[model samples]
Target: MKIKLSRIDDRLIHGQVATVWAKEAGAGRIIVVSQEVSEDDIRKTLVKQAAPPGIKVNIVDPEKAVKVYNNAKYADETVFYLFTNPMEVVTMIEAGIPIQSINIGGMQFKTGRTQVTKAVSVDETEVAAFRKLAEMGVELDLRVVATDPKGDFEGKLKEAGL
Candidate 1:
């Protein structure tokens, strides 16, 4: 399978994603790689409904994603992967998925998380996961939208002293 874009956005299929990023990626399919969301029937339905017209959306757990990604049956499909956090990306890469880079879209602020950017927030565990991905040579491209200039995720991490 060809991966067009792998983005980390907690909101999953929203305005920016359903309209902008999917079109920008030129992907025929958008797969939401999240164990939590995949298991929730409501979320799966909602994500599917929110997908852009003429595009397909699949919500699969990380394990299923690995299998689906490596399957020869899907070799012709161009996919855009969406995730809620960095650790999910790490899981895929560690499972031999060969993800070269990931777009950091939005990681909304929560209690106990420090703001890394206007749209991104992270805690200790998230910081370590991001560091691990960097160590593994995965480029962390920070951009809120396709038109927005890419921000330096590494520099943001450093600035936050993460």
Candidate 2:
């Protein structure tokens, strides 16, 4: 399986992701690797429903995602991986998935999380996970849409003092 794009979007498969990002990635499949979402039948159904027409959507847990990635049955698949957090990305990488870079698309603000970019916010745990990803040599591309300029994720993390 080829990774066309790997993104961290809290909202998962929404308008921008179902349309813009998916199209930009040119992936035949969109795999949402989130343990929580995978366990929730309602969320899985909703996410699959939100996908663009003619494209397959799979909501799998981190372990299952790694299995799917290593499965020979999917060798010819081009996939766009949408993750909800940096920790899951770290999990995939640690599990032997060759994810080279990750796009920090949208991480909404919530209590205990500091806003880094307009579309991104992070708490201490998230910061640590992102730091680990960086240490692992994963290029962090911060952007909202495909047309938006890629912001400096490392610099933004520094500025936020995260």
Candidate 3:
């Protein structure tokens, strides 16, 4: 598969992702699949700037991303997919994108979200989507960076009484 790593991080293309995860995944391109970020010109530029030199960044909505993923054009490229939320990942999977594993990098705590970890948080809707992903046999690996010990994301959610 072209998707080397599928990660969910609120700070989409930040230092840790651009430097650490990208290097670990050996990805040639970083695809940020979020309609919100794709529409924001300033955010798009910022995310592009965060990418390491020589690496391409594509900020596109989920639908477009899935189409690109299914197309043969990027068959030779290694991609690290980034999403700010679980719903997007669910949408892609439901649309027939094959994602075997997902890394839960960061999800900042918002008003209605419950803290799952210092770097991860989720609300009811997110919890439901995550459960669905788990049910579909997608392994949810939780870790802040490549060096950190990976945690079983679904197990944590269950322990948190989701």
| Best of the candidates, lDDT | 2
Cα-based lDDT at residue 131, candidate 3: 86
Model 3 Cα displacement at 156 (Å)?
2.1
Candidate 2, residues 74-122, lDDT tens digits: the string is 9999999999999999999999999999999999999999999899999
Per-candidate clashes, comma-separated:
0, 0, 0
TM-score of each: 0.97, 0.98, 0.95
Q: If the candidates were sorted by their TM-score against the true structure, best first, what order would they fall in?
A: 2, 1, 3
Name model 3 segments beyond 4 Å from true: none
Model 2 weakest 10-residue run by lDDT: 153-162
For candidate 1, give the lDDT of residue 130: 91
Deviation (Å) of 37 in candidate 2 = 0.5
> Mind giving the per-residue lDDT tens digits that candidate 1 earns over 77-115?
999999999999999999999889899999999999999
